[model samples]
Target: MISCVFLATCFVAIVADAHEAHEPVVVVDSDAMRQAVLAWRSTLGPELTRQASFEFAGPVRTDWHFVPKDRLGVNWHDMNLEQRRAAHNLLRIALSSQGYFKALAIMSLDEDLRRLEASRPNAQNVRDPERYWFALFGDPSSDEPWGWRIEGHHLSLNFSSVTGQVVSVTPAFFGTNPAELRDGPRAGLRVLGTEEDLARDLITSCTPAQLKTAMIAETAPGDVIALPGVEINFGEPEGLSAEEMTDAQQALLRNLLDEIIGNFNAELRERALDELEDAGFDKLHFAWAGSVEVGKGHYFRIHGPTLVIEYDNTQNNANHAHLVWHSPDNNFGADYLQRHYAESPHHQSAK
Candidate 1:
């Protein structure tokens, strides 16, 4: 048998390797991410820094959308290599390893689109992975509140912090053109494969009576934004609640939720989970619409007191897909800001 000391050393080495394998799983407080953001901005000085910064209450922070449209911020494409790396460093801290890899993989698809330009209609140069923009809402170091976003075609991540702790990471959006690159230089690739499969599994697991209430529509819209105005309720919770779901159905629902919101960094992921748990899973609703088969139009949504996760695969013959997670109550740290404003009535978040 191995010596006790050697066995202990082996166990420690295994733990170290596991830690190395999953780096971002370590809890990083908002102050660390804030310092990274400020240090990165300092390199640009006033002009460019001011250009990239925006007011917390400005339209840019609230005028959210996932479609390819004119956005206001400093585009990554315009930044130097070092500046781009600094921006990516902030993202590295802000997103989990799973999320960050998913993001970079989505960016690679831009190259795939470029290669398939003759046949792909979305070959516009706007899809350049580097074209993503970053804009900070205020000074994160100070006591006041602030927010930030790393956004571009098919990817948008919004993060808001109160007093250096992330309070809201809502409106996280991820999408793709050819959900599966069946044939190409980069064939057999599916970034969001699990997200889709889990929901489908939950839907298929439902009983006929459960599905009757769950299937709200025969044809899902080609896309859904889940923005502020979007109706979270398709119609009086048109599906079974967690309380009524079978044991297996409930487990699938929980796992489906875990897969979706758990894409963020550890700290923010816990915050999202806390919000969901506080809302009570029994209060959550799982609904489905459109055809149930692959390569057919389909959509599903998980809506709760403050959380909404929407997925629509209705474009490109059900190849194009959009997924967004929204927390209406805490969006942009609105609830936190409201509390802060009430306590200090005269204090404004942005000077």
Candidate 2:
């Protein structure tokens, strides 16, 4: 049986706005995100803005998903050239260059899927690179807190800000249906190749005892355990604790984490590292499921007090991959907003 006695502080709280409320604030370097969001909103005009904007306290802010279906907001297909350019600027502000390009690659895969699934009914209508949508919660220029999301097939990025500081960027999800393109123009291309390779390396390097403890199950699940539109609860920590790993293995684990968290800009990445350090990094757990060999279904998780990362490569014969990074204490800037609402003079005066 896996031990539940790892971290003294690793439980999910189901608050009124649990998922978004307690999310930790990883301060962004500048107000670029707010500026970019405002710039993007400017190009939308009144009608599109009405469609894309929502109240910060509304249910829409927490309603996040990464599937291909009708979404509420302005999609790239409906945007003009200027709107598209502004949208890209907003995305660049929210993500690192590598992450920005990776998102673009994921968007491109929609077209690839359209072609590959051409024979399937409704494939053509369902798969389009421009299907990605952008949404804003509250006025970006206002003194109150605000948030935004950009979601489409295989991508969902939720960001929240309070008083010009980016408080949350959780439920950050990225997936690829054809993990490795076989015959497209970008043949053999793997957008999430680093995410896969680093995990495989860490799992394969585990010693006999380490592997025994880390390998939680013989079979990998078809999808990530933490699905969309739900409160994340992984129960207790159930994996090999970092205390069990050697120096080299620990370094490898940190590298894997950096590759994932570093997808954000420099300031956010550094703050994330600080968070890990503040929370007892050695208390983190690494768990693996299924075969570690390439082309075989596999899943792995890195769970800690401040962070949760779940990766699965189990669908389409291990050719589909999903990766997510979430903060337990703060998923949607819950911590920051809670403080802001309690302490802000404007909010207090309104009350």
Candidate 3:
């Protein structure tokens, strides 16, 4: 036990030193988030804890998808009202208020879809937001590595931390069907509205020569291109570079980026912007696909080194929309995993 503790201490020391040498790019609201999740765990017994967890190295950690399906871990329906409220607390802390509100709005769409699709055979139970599941991978720890996920239809948020420092939050995704409600209390609601409108303004402003390089396809894909848990090989990015944008167009681009990434808390937004700056805005490629008309099938992708944002509105007759952020270098705890593996060369993740 003493030897194990010694080794762990030494490994942590190395990570700490590395961290101190650089600015904390990935800042987590750790105290609040930890307290929330830990509070939720305190309400569960050992069996419940075990049932709600998987190894950090397990397949379950990578089993993220945007579709609505039953997933492991304690779900909203499995919890009583109190537990449900606690889950919302976790979401509130982890997400920006804008993000939290967007999530709530997206969840609300499920009821509309359920009512609209009840006639479909055996599909009535498909869109319950209460079915969202939360699972902690590995034990909850402030001095060791751990991760968690809260996922359901139209939403998937995965976060990774080491010794309470958040290192990654991706492939984060948020999507909505019936992207706009034509008539209802929710009429004119567009959960991912800014992502679409801004991209269109930029794409439409593409000059004839610029459009040639930016228009990758005649039709948009039905969903975001990069799949979960995989590196996206988008090939050499093709589009008008940020260096070519007019001042007004550049402002539009900046707004689009903010809308896309500002869904996270301030720290995350800053870290992402820092990375974007490092890559240089001139390196970003804005590519468009499909019809230019509003309320029609369309897609746009902002691709750059270490960053990718995809928005697609090609389903539900272009009324459904999907938006996602990807970090090819940092999904599923990749950054932490690299640091951890460096110090524990002989250590293997618990299977």
Q: Which candidate achieves the best lDDT against the true structure?
A: 2
Give me the candidate number with maximum TM-score: 2
Residue 22 of model 1 has an lDDT of 70
What are the per-model numbers of colliding residue pairs? 0, 6, 0
Candidate 1 to truth, TM? 0.88
For model 2, where is the 10-residue window of minimal lDDT?
A: 1-10
For lDDT, candidate 1 versus 3, the one ahead is 3
lDDT of 2 at 75: 83
Model 1, runs deviating above 4 Å: 1-24, 119-124, 225-235, 349-351
lDDT of 3 by residue, 1-351 (tens): 112123223433554575679644445565667778888877767877777888877889878988888888987667765666677778767876567667777776777787778887665688665667889987665455677898889889998876566678888899988899787555787878878889999999888888898899999987888977566788877777888878888889999998878778777777778989988988888889999999899989988887888899999899999898888778877866887778875534643
- Candidate that beats the other on lDDT, 1 or 2, i.e. the better one: 2
Q: Deviation in angstroms for 254 in model 2?
A: 1.3
lDDT agreement of model 1 with the native? 0.76
Candidate 2, residues 292-338, lDDT tens digits: the string is 89999999999998888999998898999999998877888887777
> Local distance difference test, per candidate?
0.76, 0.82, 0.78
Which residue pairs clash within candidate 3?
none
